[model samples]
Target: MARTRTLLTAGAFALVTALLPTITTVGAAAADRDGPGPVAVSESRGQLTVTVPPGHGGPGYRLLIDEKTLGVRTVRAGRTVLATNPAGGFAFGDQHATSVTTWSYAAGTLRIAAASTAPADTVAVAITPTADRYDLTWSVAGAPAGARTVSYQLSSAGHWYGGGETSEGAAQPYPLDAGQVSEPDFSPASYLMMEPYWYTSSSVGNYVRTASPMDVQINKSASGLGDFTIKSTDSYASTVFVESTPSAVYQDYVEVVGKPSKSDATPAEIAQPLWNSWAQFYTAIDQNKVLDWAGKLHAAGLGGHTIQLDDKWESNYGNLTFDPKTFPNPKAMSDQIHSMGYHFGLWTTLWINLDSANYAYAKDHGYLLAAAADSTKPCTVTWWNGTAGIIDLGKPAARDWYTGNLHQLMSTYGVDGFKFDTRFFDDSCAPAAGVQAGDYQRLGAEMADGFDLQGAGVRVHWGNQKYGFVIRAVDAGTSFPELRTTLRRSMAISTDGYPFVETDMIGGSLGEPAPTKQVLVRWAQAASLMPLMYSSTSPLGVVDHTTGKPVTYDPETVQLYKNAIARHGRLSDYLQAQARKSVADGTPIIRPVFFDFAADQRFYTTDDEWMLGPSVLAAPVLSDSPTRTIDLPAGAWFDTVTHRVITGPRTLSAYPAPLGVTPAFVRLGAPGAATAIAALSHQS
Candidate 1:
């Protein structure tokens, strides 16, 4: 009988726990983690230490960053015990131990290679020290002749998160016990993206780099052991990177990975706000409304040069043509918009509608994944609309057609770029033709890269978070509850090392009823301090319940909105320069305060506020309260509004945050920045 590959149940994995793996708390008084064995520990200059146990599946590896224990984890529990019958000429005569045959530490490098019988050789693990992190590599002697799956897992203490869109930006507790995957997986409960990156309260970032697809399991053991598995179908080697960069998580990952930049954009374009039509008009939006709004926006002092024309303009998802009924003259419409000092962009996706004309054309042209064509059948993805045939990016010509259409929109109709939106598990739809998910991802990136404009905004999970494009937060609503979530989501994206990020807006995305006047002002106030301030909600769209008419912003509210944009415009050049540096070091322009103030324990708990670039720290009022309390790290800082120099290493009393202003302070830590507000004013 031929052996089949299946996910080993958590129950099956827990059985190995009986081996009594040795675990050390690293922190004082670790009880359950201690097992029978001597731990071989190694420390690096980067303040990271790793421990190896003497017994089989001993606590596995206990990791510590800055003397703070990240908990002990094991990687040996998932090693498959093969039961194939070699009698059918399927197995080699001799057998080798599937476990590590030898382990050694030399000159800051740890080599732990496994010896397996015949074709079942496990990867050789190598951990080398870098300036700031340990570069981990897992490789075989050469390319394997057959497909294989390998997994590396670990368990940590306290709270954990950082799995891109999968973790949903919320820190979740690992189950203290084990069980089967019982619930209908919703909101991407486990792994997200082809990239498997995660972080813990310990301030460590784990970057998984492999050509293979990844499966992440949290709380696989009832005892809360989280596991990350990489299944490589055709590769000979795979690598997963983990490092303790407690000082700066964003800078650490980008430095190890590649730094990304928008090559063609100017500094102004880099920091400019985006005006979106989604909330204002949805499918009802037309060229007239866009042009009319441009005038109104200018009158209201919110005119921006870039505009993103979101969904519903296209007749069909993948048709890639402007709806003739709604947009009769796209070229002229685009020209008029450009004349209004705006570069137009369209919202699009690779989703080919089954009933649309493009579907028939693509189906006939072999531009989709098919079954008889190897198990690589095309899958249907359902979203807010209905099901649609996914355009097979795994195929080159198919990708060409996809990009070609978008280019046509740019060259012919004056459409400058795209907001590439895709929220789904792409690996599930990968063709059986033996291509890795990265193939499709690279193709999508190719399409986005080929766009002439600098603002090719993409939601994560499609590919690695690269520089050339902007990263936007997933759609969020205007309610206080969802508002909090949206803010946290953006924080996660920043700390995850996405430099240029955009929150949906003050009043949220389309289909949302306008937020109350307070929410609108506060949201806008918060957004203005982010990397990019964008809005889909109009100034006067929020309805007044009693009058049944759009509520107009008071003069003060309008000035506040205009003041925020005007201020950002003046500082755009300086902001963009700081943003440009992230490509080399992976630093975040709009990041959590922990990046610079890691010593302050309060930063980890304060998720609602963020730092704009390296200069100002902003805390937006989340409630209807007139003032909100904030913890200021040890530093000399001045309120941006008042330029009042305040020394702080303590919590500030309820700070005043009126309806129109977001509380922000500029750091004056250096002698050159002694008058921080003055220094900032001069630069802007």
Candidate 2:
């Protein structure tokens, strides 16, 4: 029998529906009227099953209209252990679980009881079903002594996209599924981003609602479907959102997290490119060097609005002042940067080197974290820079003092904002702080509220959406493969909800071997299509290390590079508009193509191509090949280069993308179609 009790809690779900004003349906399911409606529930011997229509069809579940599977689910519970150290290392002990003892469904919720060993006598789970999603919570009657691992079994098959940043070198073939992710082998490093949310191509999304260090693993069964095992240190609740399309699932998540806060970056900031000192000069940057780079950037007709001084700008790590030796007359440098029509951004971290002049004062004042071993002494941790004392941002006084120092620096030196840099967890000193790494990161970021803040070495959380600053890709090397890696990194991070995305420098960081002319031009073309195109290596000055001479692009390559920036400039308004919409809802400005075409499996593996808002699709060449194939999801696509409208589901094989051109298509009837098409036409 089917029960039709609505899942809208008097206050909780009512708020969710109000936030999600627009609900799009996928496949053949009946269009959801208003917000989500009641879900179907049925019970069997000792077990209960709830069904919500999936966005797409699958073989293992009950069929719905258009052959779509009604996603079925059952919950289970287990136990595990979490250990962390000062070196930002974490380990999880072996895990064990118990089967469901009994289950009952009533008033839109399914409750399951389970038996556990000592420390935890019993475990109870309550799953409340809504229109196309469910909220699951678990609790123990007795202390588990360790962590609890909750899991859900879904009879669906598809690739997984979210769940934080992709591990380094694991970028291609899109989704992290089956063979790509496994238990024990797939460790917390994969979850370093600490974003415990994942949405799949099958239109199922899982969000582990806990800040505690947790491990999320997805593995395919022999039958092709998969299991989501989320182990957290504390008993917690998680939500499972099902929709007809991945985009709807993402929107549902955004509603829960709330829209981007007003403090997010301004429209002008979103539209302009950022130039950083790290990629070009690294720690060797000086006052004169910055000015020279700014002049060179201007001469190239690249009006980058922000020039960031990355690592080594500070007199010492966490000192929050310019190094006098490298940046003599810091105030004058800031004024010159501002006079040149740019925002001066300084890099910062919480690590205060013991050698720093202010270290003793901070330690004496209770601003520094105490060593875990000796509460009387300040903690010392070694990092790339050196061993340093970390500021205890968890303390309100410490945060206020830190904020005041930055404000003083900015006011005295004409600094417009800061690029906050620090590992998500850095406790080389084994600090005895009670604050989790994620909390500390959020607190540190909050101190930069209202400033032109950007995150480099930080974690991405849904709550931080309000900060509205750009989150950049990790450093990239100067290789064609690395260029592709940069693209995958952006797509992964963007889909994880850092909407205002920025790529590293044009030709990769200067730390690696210089890119050849071809690689540099190709990288420039690809980065131009992202939300923010960052450049550091001077287009006119980068030396070709292989030849020991300036990397000189031919007329075609040069034109292609210039054309990329021109196209980006022309579409700036469209990008800004999409960014605003993302703030209003929870959608990303630059996202995987699957977000729109989830029913089409062909796009599930797409990593190189991306959708810039709804109107434009960019297919930048990411390899050394002179030509590449292009796959267009169902749509009326207007090819920018040929000026022809090609209807697809169609595949354009061996698309002629010469040295100086990238393939981009503008959807004919999307909201910003006219503006995007016009931009492409102007570029062509």
Candidate 3:
């Protein structure tokens, strides 16, 4: 007679069996001496199981669920199973993709079932660990059409298990170790992959789950590839889901706080110009020329809270010394700027030039990172003026020396804040000796922490992307609370894209034409909602690099930017309050569609439209057309421009987007402040 089912029972064992019509059992003679010769097949209820023959090789074992084979592990000593990474799975053909791992069972079977949404399509796997007898299910959906297959492999002596497509034959395997770290390539066109390994020892009591922390490498392939990576660690304990698709989210605010006040007791009066450098620029063009611009800005009610002396305000970029011959009295420039109701702001970078007086000072202290062991690789890199070398922030002595100089300038010269620039380029320095790639994050964090300690009250002007790495520099009142926790290095989207605090170069760098009227209008409307906003028109207001400078500004463009800035200033009180609330609640002032309409299918893939705050919905036209169409969310919305009311969940066409207008609306009954920012009319 054909062999029937044979039960192996032990005290306190949790047994779950799935029986199928094709059930078959092996007799005692076929059982191996070591164990049950690795049960080839077992099934009961909805569960299925298969064990690999010990020491078996090739491409690990495969589990045929619904006739679709999913890869499993084949180990020599004991059985090993593969599971998906919680974050996501890797892309099949693209190096930028992410991946996930599956869970294994001690003595029980696992079940694969069809997803509720997609019938007949097995979209989930359930693993039952006999040790805990806990059934945990991992659902898989949202797999792009590109990833059609998933396979796994095991090598003889390598601790790294390889994973790839059976048909593709190319595998990217990561080593399994306690402290092993790798930056895995991730891109919009690829998928994310993750694998989990668990060690179970009878001598060690219970099974311990182990996973490798992978840094998702984003934007590594192409410049415009709209993809970003997120770092993952084994400490993460949460259910992971693959969202439909990802888009960028922007949040953060900028505030200019150097405006002078009429009363000496006011907040503005207490703030003073921290540094003076106007003499360097004024020496070229007489003192009268320098004062003329200051008077014009004051007369036009446009004097910045802090008067920034741009490049050339210094004798040299690398030289931190003052040019006494030019200024005669450096203190007078600071007093003049302060008397005119503005704090003085200066620009500086980390470079130390050979020609500068500080170069010898820095060299004597051994502050710079030497390129060669001989200390003579010439710490040089090209910048604005000429060749220079950067002071290594990673070293404590260097940080102390740099901070001491800055502190002296702040305390002695009354300098309020430093406009730091150009420290992001990593290629400039030869990798420091004894520095490893994993130490990058900690080193950056340490530098930021040091800056925070030194410049306790002073504000640091930071670039948008740099903010992700050194957020600790933002002072208490300066930082938006909501952005603190979410600022990661490689987010899915651009952090600077939103109208936030770090002054965004208005038209963007690279000498692109000033944003089109539509871009400006949208930017203006969005900016109006930020804590701080400023217009960074190209130097001399000329943007086209090809044309040498008969700089002509459109009267309309000037009026629009002027109006936008003034309007932003006028609503500063309200915007500041909103920003404070956003920080307190950990919600962004600029929210994407999914935030407000998560369950709404219509807004799932929408990127162009976003909410400025809780009440206002801004749909800025990205195209050049004077009029554009906008889709509104559900409920009634009051037109911010026309005051015309309309119901949402519908698209409105031919919305006017003239040079100064942005197609914006406020939800009806929502509390918000909307003020027109048109130039004042002078009627005779």
Highest-TM-score candidate: 2
lDDT of 3 by residue, 1-684 (tens): 122232234221123232233443322222222233333444433223443332211112323222112322223224333232211222222321121122223233344332222332324454332111122333335433332212122122112211110011111111221112233432111112111211111100101121222223212232211111222321211111111112111111111111111111112211111112222232243334345455545665532455554445555656764556554455677678678876665556677777887777787777776664345654676665677777776667876887777677666666655555434223324445576423433354345433321111211221122232211111111111111111111011212222233223333322333344444444544444433433333222333333433344455655665565555555444444444444343344454554565445555334456665566675655455578778888888777677677887878878776756656667766545342212111100
Tally clashing residue pairs in candidate 2.
6
lDDT of each: 0.55, 0.64, 0.37
In angstroms, the error of model 1 at 315 is 2.2
For model 1, residues 460-547, the per-residue Cα lDDT tens digits are 4423556445666666766666666666666656656666766666676545666776777777777666767777676755443334
Ranking by TM-score: 2, 1, 3
Model 1 bad stretches (over 4 Å): 1-161, 166-195, 201-203, 211-225, 229-245, 248-250, 261-265, 371-377, 423-425, 432-434, 452-456, 460-466, 542-552, 669-684
Ranking by lDDT: 2, 1, 3
How does residue 499 of candidate 3 score in lDDT?
20
Compare the candidates by lDDT and give the number of the best one: 2
